[model samples]
Target chain A: MYQTNQYEGMIAETVSMRGHNGDVINAYVARPLGAGPFPGMVVIHHAPGWDEWYRECARRFAHHGYVSISPNLYFRDGHGTPEDVGAKVRAAGGAPDARVLGDLDGANAWLRSLPYVSRKVGIFGTCSGGRQAFLAGCRLKGLDAVIECWGGRVVQSKEELTPNQPVAPIDYTKDLSCPIIGIFGNEDKSPTPEQVNAHEAELKKHGKQYEFHRYEGAGHGFFYYDRPAYRQEQAVDGWKKVLAFTEKTLR
Target chain B: MCTMIAHQVRIQGRGKSGPEWFEVHEANVSYDHPYDLPLEHALNIDFVNETLGPGARVAVELSVDAARQLVKTIEAVLAQADQRGVLEDRPVAAEPARSPSVA
Candidate 1:
């Protein structure tokens, strides 16, 4: 794994593509500079908006030899500071699930269309992004794998369901088209341990290829080194598993 | 975990977002992650004029205790103003003041 000199480089930039209803949307693309085709990864930003952290996340995937695509799901709302747009979107009761799915589908297509792509793609998401990742894995046809890290609201109670999210994501388990590995914190409130168990049961019932890793003494957003919830040991191990899963499944 | 819990109400207020002050037409409140706070989550408040754009916002993140205390304090001040007959619920000018740079 160690080489003193390996030809290494990457290109990261912003690009526009068609999203829902053929509307053009912005997305960040990061890819290694070599000529051979590379595996693809779609990085869906959390509810915090498509901020700097997610952009860096795309680059991190590129560094690991995956072509990463991160779309600004809130682009239709407005553009400003990430926090401002995030707050506005939250106030409006989160980005419409339909819209996010459409944007993600578009991003996946754009990534597959790239000349340097391997045609296999994995999706990575945290918080609400995680929920969308799982939803996409079920609703979209081409995703090869899913890394759903601490996604909440997948098992919504009838009361928790909103007009925008009329059905629970778990209800779509039968449609999951790819193997999925989940990263969850035991202490997470939204998807409590029980909800995680329920999600597992659904997968088991459907006989879907899936795995879940639960971390003790950690809560939501454990990989966000920028936040207080970051757990060094857990995040390190989790990253190893995520990269391994992507490699084994997509590469 | 993103609760996706938030509510916005129309309000008349002036808020200083960054260096300049602007007229705020809405107050959005929620319990969610904060942009500047160190904790996992907070009771967030946003004073904004959405028509002016996303930047027309002054945001605050407070702990649960702090948010409750703020609500009680606001009630107390309003009660005192009401008892003293000094409350000015209506604006002196029918038209609200506007900020040129903020707009």
Candidate 2:
């Protein structure tokens, strides 16, 4: 798609919505200004908390003709900088999986309520959010696609499981309802190449529609430009794959 | 991978933030992604007093070598003080009780 001198407009802001157990929560929503209809995306922020990157990512999706919503998963953790809230969450052994899933469900519902929404909605997550996205595909309904980027602990040992994250995400593979795409760094420690392979085998056993793009010479959080893990070449290619997946499954 | 790795310990110290000093009641230590460090992961230490709000905190990120060196340096200094009879002989104390409302 190519266009010269095309008019462009967008609106980005924080909006309130009901999250898990009917609790009101804040969500960063970005939508194209002049849109007859647009696909929707629920952008789940990483474990670092609902910080700046996720907000910017919502705008990026809006630019690409999608309504994007990023819910504040740590809203109840209290008002503070991302680091402060994230540190608190980490100290508490992370947010409960049920609560996070409920929030994601609420975000999807809010997207569908929008007038310009195309009825197609997808979920994108990186880091801990990625793992939650995968869990959503299995546990939630109405999502068309799932984009899991470098989700660690998808395959967790029993001893590694916490009360907040009681069950291993791998156990939900057979329940996955939508197609999923995974982006990973070959050198990541949590989901090492072997773990990825194991996860792929589970998907294959369940015959799920899925695609995985693994990059060499990269490690966890390679897509994080602000961090030392950023790898331009791999990140670019991985993004292309992500967009392609969204196009095929969401658009 | 979001390591989700962190440990918290109670401590008693006064930390200065800007022009003001606040009591630091706890420290959180972890090996995970650093906000500003130029590495995949770093040993992060956060000195905090949650009652004083999120602003009453001091954070530092260091490489493994730096962290180990710092720990050894601290122990060495304490040992030197002990040898000089500058440190009082004290029994091990229990972890300080946190504010009941903190949770």
Candidate 3:
């Protein structure tokens, strides 16, 4: 049993699992206090790993009756704190897709093995986390739904300043076994309107169930409450949409 | 010679809902170099309006220079105390040219 913290009706717990080559991965799990099985959600962290805000998000989902687990993706590289991991990630250029995908697989396996978790599982992420969520939907088996918030780089260029290898989610639309909902700020520069449209077209071509919401006047990181770019109204509304989608797809 | 005092006001509200009313009270503070000027009131109003927008209903008040200085000092102290993290933080991606909105 994991030590639990109660917030509003949700129970938060810290857990650890083994990942690629037996690397220990740390995660925060939040869920309603109940005995029977419940729907589970895998919450992937943005570039900065396992920050307090992400933990609060897991608690919010748990309060809504879903089991949410947030995995610290950069733990394998000995990046413990957000600031430390952020610095190291910067020094290394950008996150390699191979490491990120392996982390997601380890997280998924952990969630599936939990006795309290139901067979229905979903994945959600913001920013870099959002990209991982899309990858999980297409690459991972048994995911019922995915929600991506402002996931940048649906198309990639090697010469770009960001140095992204560009694993376009559009290319994997045909492989998705479940619905994917993407939320973005119209003012965001990273995932510009053109990229969003390209992704939508790919989904349409594959006949995949998907929804895209764009908030006017909001910018990147609008959903982050601690940041100046936060748009409280838009973020709340987006959360509503995310919950509705998850319930519809997972239930 | 004139010394301009800078103040920041944050207006918070919920979705599509109108702005909630808030109040502020003036505090006594010493003005260095320049004693007082009429533009102070107008400048304060402009600052509040620009940051919070026109629809927001806000109460006006003066804060001491010491208060502002204290905040700066506290921020500096916090920054110095902050332990650096291992990961390097990157700035948000630069904005791209506007294209057609998705249907």
lDDT of 1 by residue, B1-91 (tens): 2777788999987888666777888999988878778877789998988888877888899999999999999999999999999998896
Off by over 4 Å in 1: B91-103
Give each candidate's fraction of reference contacts reproduced. Answer: 0.75, 0.42, 0.00
Give the clash total for candidate 2. Answer: 0
> What's the TM for model 3?
0.66
Highest TM-score: give the candidate number. Answer: 1
- For candidate 1, write residues A118-171 as lDDT tens digits: 979999999999999999999988999999999899999888788777789999
Please give me the DockQ of candidate 1 compared with the native complex. Answer: 0.71
lDDT of each: 0.89, 0.87, 0.65
lDDT of model 3 at residue B6?
28
Candidate 1 chain A — worst ten consecutive residues by lDDT sum? A1-10
| Candidates by TM-score, descending order | 1, 2, 3
Q: What TM-score fits each model?
A: 0.96, 0.93, 0.66
DockQ, all models: 0.71, 0.41, 0.02
lDDT at residue A227 of model 2 (Cα atoms): 78
Docking class of 3: incorrect
lDDT of 3 by residue, A151-178 (tens): 7665444334243334565577789889
State which candidate has the highest DockQ: 1
How many Å off is the CA of A110 in candidate 1?
0.5
